[model samples]
Target: MLLIEALTTGGAQRQLLNLAVQLGGRGHRVSVVVYHLADYNHRDHFRGEFERAGVPVTDVPVMAPWRRLWAVRRTVRAAGPDVVIAFLRRPGLLAELTALPARRFALIVSERTGKEGGRDMKDLTRFQLHRLADAVVANSAHLEHYVRTAAPWLRTRLRQITNSVDLDHFRPAGAPPPPHPGLRILAIGRFRPEKNFLALAAALRILRTTEPALDVTVDWYGNNFFLGQQPTGRSRPYLELLDVLRETGLEDAFRVHPPVGDVVALYQKADVLCLPSRYESLPNVVCEALACGLPVLASAVSDNDRLVRDGENGFLFDPHEPRSIAEAIRRFAALSADERAAMGRTGRRLAEELLSPATAAVRWADLVEQVVEARRAAW
Candidate 1:
């Protein structure tokens, strides 16, 4: 069984969806449990894909706080999953606290963040409950180190699993839409304060002045609100970016796209993929772009060093400094069209070496079997 807050358009959720489909193909019966979602028609509606794949997905009905635990427990009990794994922190807590008592099923919780991996209250409890989990899955070397430091007693088991990307669907496809004699930049992430789009706007403003003849345009794809409906002016952060663009006379040079079910076409058309997040563990966007044979321009955070070889596949910069971002952009923009295409091809090779979904799913299946056998032997 896989547990998560919601089957929304997020990285962890998408990874689990891909893993579940692959696991099912490997002759495993997979079921999903999600908390706090009212229906399957909302958000990214990833639940529909699971259903279409014939994977049973149960959205535990919303209820009072205390009752929700029981609801999750009841739901898990019904599913009778031998191994209960959760994709994010909140659901991992629930899986550890509840799934252990209901059955001796092996529990695996995934930690997929870098520096901001811990919290004051919830992490304390989670660290204490680490003993109960059969294993901890960290998606990057940075995240794996973070977990080991925070919970040193995890002689239990900490495995670094590169977050999976669908190489088959994400590869370079049809020719990009009518191309102008300029560079196209693509960014994907939430429109939150952490994403630091305002800084990106500043960097783009610099790019406009520094390279007046070069037609550089940015297409950012994401949403601020991921749960369900957007609250009043929830797009304020995205709009503020627009304000920055308009004030700097860059409104025409940038475009913001809402979340989408598929972004392969976006990757195919773009010259490069850019992620300006202030922090990230191992962003799915970077992996997806690399798999799509799109050169990357990303913040120097997490294990991006392993993925991007400076000027080879992409350029990484200090996300905190707009000038730093601009400098990296300048480096990428300096490359000739053939040079940029070569970088993208190199990135695709890296993706195959590191982020292949087939390799990832095999590792997950092997780990599950090992944990399940260990638990069974203990019993």
Candidate 2:
């Protein structure tokens, strides 16, 4: 059984959905359990896909903290899975709880990211709960380091599977369309502080004043799901970003669009892909762009160093500084057409090497088998 908060559209959500589908295709019986009670209807964006893949999905939509645990317990007992793997924080904690004396399944909890306040008691407590897990999976080396630092005992069970992109879905298209006035830059992700669109707006302001002759445009494809759907009187992160764009007087240059199901077309349309995120384990958008043969300009964080080789395939910038973001764009713009195309080819090669979905699923399956066997041996 694969457990997650909800099937909402985000990097982590999308990655888990892909993995679930891939694992099902590999002749494994997989089930998804969603327990996010608030706005359950709005968050099940992938229900149709799960149904199409013939993977059963069960919802444990209960609001009360104790009731939610009982709901997850019932769903897990019904699934009768040999292994119960949960993704993200809350689900991880629940998976650990489900491993009480009566439970027979081996538990594996996957962590996709880490944040500031490494010494925070809340984060440390979560890491300590991994002692109940048969194995702890982290998508990036940085996250693995994070848990190891928080709880050294996790070293023996820690596993790194990395993030993956479906190459067949995100392949190179014909020569990219020419820009109308100048270059076309693309950014894709949810609107949040960590995505750093506000800093991107600041960089656009820098470009607007410093490089007046450079008539470049930015297209941000997103659903503004960072804070999720807004409620009455709540501060909307998406709206706040728009306000920042207007304040910087670059609203015309930076355009935001609704998220698309087929994002490969968006990649095909853009000259360069820019990700100015303050935090990421391994951003799915970057891998998609690379697979689509789009040159990249990404933040230098986490495992981005492995995915994007500076100057060879794409440029990396300090996401904190708007000046650094603008400077990287300038560097990318200075490259000749042939140089840029060569960079795209290098990115495509990197995608093939680093982000194969089948390979990732196989690695995950291998870990599941290892953990299950270890548990059986102990029994």
Candidate 3:
């Protein structure tokens, strides 16, 4: 099997790594092809992890859009694998296009984001590339719905498999931290505008003022660099929020940490996990935090409503409203120890049932087998 993706880190990278290791151990040859060769933050860590797992990994240089086609064709043909599995829209589209002549091998496309719509030309290309794939995989049911709309013919070919984390590694079972004086607010993800870290900072500032007695410290563990190669128009919202934080003079209150492999340690120390994203299909941090027995406060978007039961495991707030976020933080901070523990337990139960690595691998394995069988029958 060949797994193709751009960069590493984020939920998508971790899922791919887990799948490669699991599938490779079962007598299946697995190879990973990353498009970037530069030693950025995520790539550095991922290179080590992939090497440790004994998976054959390659990094090729292809910066431009058109150049990617040649890169895709060259890599897939060179690997000559039984199947090619790709994550993210661009790499998936490339896999489908390049695997056209290699009809004996099945091409699988995985969607990690929501319907990005016309904002990106790649969305249109993905729509056109759908028919070339043996199957389309969506991490959430909400994303599957969007996929179906993009390519109606692929509706019968679409399947849902939520992203997974290593349960044992991410569990509440970790070394305890020394008791801290303040309420430690933790957030994790890539340092992209989509993450809306600025909004989180603004909300923390507001909460500090409104609830002065609450000693609060916000710690962010996100991607070491800013979002993408270039900024999108949607970036303005995040920039505005950052300006608010700087103007209000709260830079010292909230600190951003470089990405680390042992996120479980941060989750264990955190009082609450905040996922204030402008957009998200499904976030792995919230799931990881829940598995670590930390309550979550996330924006109600896409699968968030399905994952988080308001006032149960955690509360959902409007991403556009800083005041709403502040209030939710206040509510979480005010909860009794028992109440908070109950919320954490509820989150863990949900994660065990829905987001375990074993569960995800089984689902994906079944889907890949089915797609391969269907392709054989079609021939």
Model 2: residues with Cα > 4 Å off, grouped in runs: 40-42, 225-235
lDDT of each residue in 178-265, candidate 1, tens digit only: 6567778998877777788888888988877887776788888776552345433555776677778778888787888777777788
Candidate no. 3 TM-score: 0.89
TM-score of every prediction relative to native: 0.91, 0.93, 0.89
Query: How far is 107's C-alpha from truth in model 2 (Å)?
Result: 0.8
RMSD of 2: 2.2
Worst 10 residues of 3 by lDDT: 226-235
How well is each residue in 26-77 modelled by candidate 2, as lDDT tens digits?
Answer: 8878889998846522367677778888888988875898989888988898
Which ranges of candidate 3 are over 4 A from the true structure?
A: 37-39, 115-124, 174-178, 226-244, 376-379
Better of 2 and 3 by TM-score: 2
